[model samples]
Target: MGREKRIEYEGAIYHVISKTVSSENAFMEEKDYRHFIKLTCDAFSKYQAMLLSFALMKNHYHLLIKTEKANLSQIMHEINSKYAHYFNSAHIRKGHLFQDRYRSYLITNDEYFINAFVYINLNPLEAQLVEQLEDYKWCSCRYFEDKDNAPRCLNFKEIHNLSGIEIARITQFIMSKVSESKKYGREIKEHNSEENIKKIREISAEIQNKYGSIVKNRELKYLLVYALCSKKFKLVDISFALKMSYATIRRIKNKVEKRMTSDAMVTEWLSEIGKVNAFDYQNDHKVPGTL
Candidate 1:
């Protein structure tokens, strides 16, 4: 079966998660985690994603984000690939550092967002990495506490919306949680099961880079081919000219034309990138036409 289609909606919030490959720890040191955060910052600047909250753990990481017109898959790939490259080179290791696919749960309701925020803030505590959440150095917990290196991750507006808690109360709540978790103990289990079942609707809107929103894929492919082709043709005209599925459209854009290409071209190209293997735009080395 084809890879499951990820649910993407405009202004959608997501709790993104990923673990180290083979259960091997992804972070060898604190510096590694810091580098991962740095890379995550880079990805946010490059993509159309907005960070409501984010936290990096020892074995796994979490990102509570809101996306506008970007694909989550591409965004995660970019962030993970860069971090992996950084970690591998730094540690002198040579294989996959993270699991194959990152887990993503789209958050469309306030309840889920709240739980996600709490869970993310309390990750270190849950992992037993630190006695208190704030004690963890690499997490949104510190971001919420100190204003330094913040405003990049924490969007206080969302926090302010919770029970009319202004920035002051927002900080108060977080600070209070830290102290409460310390006093009452971080061992207190925060239940997200009920909130996770919040009603969320799935959406399917196409937003290609620089290109406008496209609903159909067949024409998408035709346009991709046309762009690569020396042949001059209008997208509007082509859209009406041939009606094709969006997959065909995406395939066309990716230069995937099984019958159109010669056997030699097919063999050589397929050998490099077949059905199961394709160039990952997330990786600079895997990009086509780049030396």
Candidate 2:
């Protein structure tokens, strides 16, 4: 069987979890944690996603994300791929870093959202990694009290609006334990029901379908490079896919970035292609849960 298709849409919230391959420590030192966090912030900004909360464990990490666009896969790809590249280079290692594609649970309502928030913050305590949630240096719990020092990627205001919990009370709420039953099996039934939104289309295919032949269209080729890069496709992989040289791919990407600022038409074209690049999941089922 093939992997399950991820359900994605604008404004969708998810509890995303990714573990290192073979349960190895993903963060070997303080610098590792800092670098991962920096990469995460950059990815969020580049993809226009909002991070509500996060907890980084030794082997695994949890993230509560509310995507403003239907580009969760793209966002995660950038973060994971970039971090894996950095980690492998820093440690003089190679091969896969993560065990598999990250797992995500759709959060459909405020109740489940709050539950996930608390659940993520409590991971350290549940694993006996820390006696106090605030003492966990890697989690977002401590940032609730020190917003000025928190990563710019974290959206505490959105968290308050969605969870209906005030920013000031968030730390207190997380510290208070909820029922154990609420923690497990709380994800909705629709999470298990899979429906094909659309088959994954390559950047070349999308460009060809939208703009016809690109053999002589220099602008379209640049758009292709931009779209592929936005999806976190490596330069070498893109070169193979487009039958272009590595230097040409980088040149096209640079050109696209420059054009985006000065050319409105170019910017519009890229924006339209971005929507095409995002996963579109049509879900009508009501998510059941209560606080």
Candidate 3:
């Protein structure tokens, strides 16, 4: 079969969804969900992708983002690939961890953006998991209230700007949506309930038990993300592409870099990870991980 045509969405708004492979639970606990947020907060910056809003549910995640030159494919790959690696080690499972390709819907209309935003935000309420949207501790519903940011990552300013609403108004809008909410998408509820959260704790504990032994390097993880997003490279060439210290990469992955013998299969994998050609001078001047 021919490859499906990718939707052209450069500098356009999109609603992206990624789910767990085998239709099982992806986020097993509150911290798992927090990791999802932290991952995106880091991933988005490195990719130059912009997040408008995002809502994390039990089995899947919703991301509303804008890409200038980079495509949705690369962003999701960075997320799914790294998260899968972490999840596999944590769960002691192997093979593909996420469903084939994440779903991306172009936000061509204003109503749909609002609908998507509301739909994602109301995930907990729709599932009857909570009486108030703010009650869902994993979401960013409370961020606008300036009370505290939910565990998940969200770039809330764009949606607020587009709606011409201030933070105060945004908080009011969220509360109003919750007040008028019904059974729409109520299926997002956490099922198999208590066992699920406990199971997550067990899995996380196992991973933590092995984390010191697993010895992941932060720089290597960064390199993998960078290499996964890069199109051309021999091992030496990729090695040269780094301005960051290899020791740092090794420290990041907590492992030595492996030798690549040109398996010929990496090209397609890299191709799936789209690239961005744009340059930002301001960013170039900034130090790594420094705001």
Q: What TM-score does candidate 1 get on C-alpha atoms?
A: 0.58
Q: Write the per-residue lDDT of candidate 3 for residues 107-156, one digit (tens) a residue.
A: 54455466556666676766777886666766666466654554333555
Task: Score every model by TM-score.
Answer: 0.58, 0.63, 0.57
Which has the better lDDT: candidate 1, or candidate 3?
1
Q: Please list the C-alpha lDDT of all candidates, in the order they appear.
A: 0.56, 0.73, 0.55
Per-residue accuracy of model 1 over 3-96 as CA lDDT, tens digit each: 6556665676677778888778888887887777777767777877777666676677888787766477778899888888888899889988
Candidate 3 Cα deviation (angstroms), residue 250: 58
In model 2, the Cα lDDT at residue 186 comes to 60
For model 1, what is the alpha-carbon lDDT of residue 159? 55
Worst 10 residues of 1 by lDDT: 198-207
Q: Write the per-residue lDDT of candidate 2 for residues 180-291, one digit (tens) a residue.
A: 4144436432332112112223546755665665676766667757877876655654664466787888988887788768777776666555554332323222221111
